[model samples]
Target: MNLNLRNAIIDNVSGNSQDQLEDTIVDAIQNGEEKMLPGLGVLFEVIWQHSSEQDKHEMLQLLEGGLKKQ
Candidate 1:
């Protein structure tokens, strides 16, 4: 079987408003289902691609802090 998961995810989430996107992310995290991970990753990819260097740095810092909390 051939599957294009990334494109599928992008297509699914395309045109979503900020609030709807937030709801999708929050729901996925709160649900904590492994199936939702790829979707989250796709979202992160979109964010990373569009983020400026400073935004990326801030995200890295936040990610580092979250990792430390683990």
Candidate 2:
């Protein structure tokens, strides 16, 4: 079967408000379900595509710090 998962996810969440989007993300992360990853990745892709260099740098720094907490 052929399915456009990225577009599907985007379509699903396209009209959400900021608070709804935040709740979606928080719920996905807190649930820790692998099935939710693609949606999260799509969300990140949107964020990355729209972000400035400084914003990307700050996000990378935060990601690096989070990853080092093992």
Candidate 3:
């Protein structure tokens, strides 16, 4: 993702409440629409970058579990 677009998403999301932001993220992932993928990727990238190693490991584990269920 371009830095400008990433910044734009951060700016746009900054106004949202935590629940709303989570809902938006969950919806995007659940829907799995083509257009939403890039935004989801950006979200994941941003999260992965800032997360602690333990948190990242937990997240990856959760992701693995979710993938296994599918």
Candidate 4:
């Protein structure tokens, strides 16, 4: 994803409250389609960029666990 677009999504989520952000994410997931994948990827990228090393490691672990189920 382009850096600007990624920043924009981060800004949007950051501007909203946690509950709202969760709702947005849930909606995206529930509505999952090919089109939604890019958005999710962008969100993951933004989160990865902003997260601490430990947080990133934990996220990677969680993702690995989830992927293993697929």
lDDT of 1 by residue, 1-70 (tens): 8989999999998999999999999999999999999999999999999999999999999999999999
- Ranking the candidates on lDDT from highest down gives 2, 1, 3, 4
- Model 2 bad stretches (over 4 Å): none
Q: What residue runs in model 4 are displaced by over 4 Å at the alpha carbon?
A: 1-14
Off by over 4 Å in 1: none
Whole-structure CA lDDT of model 1: 0.97
TM-score for candidate 1: 0.96
**Tens-place lDDT digits, model 2, residues 1-70:** 8999999999999999999999999999999999999999999999999999999999999999999996
User: Each candidate: what lDDT?
Assistant: 0.97, 0.98, 0.85, 0.80
lDDT score, residue 64, model 4?
100
lDDT of 4: 0.80
Q: Could you list the CA RMSD of all candidates, in the order they appear? A: 0.7, 0.8, 2.9, 3.3
Worst 10 residues of 2 by lDDT: 61-70
14 in model 3: Cα distance from truth in Å?
1.8
Clashes of 4: 0
Query: Candidate 4 clashing pairs?
Result: none
TM-score of each: 0.96, 0.95, 0.71, 0.73
- Pick the winner on TM-score between candidates 3 and 4: 4
Query: Which tens-of-lDDT digit does each residue in 5-67 have in candidate 4?
Result: 656666767778878877987888998776767667887777888899999999989989999
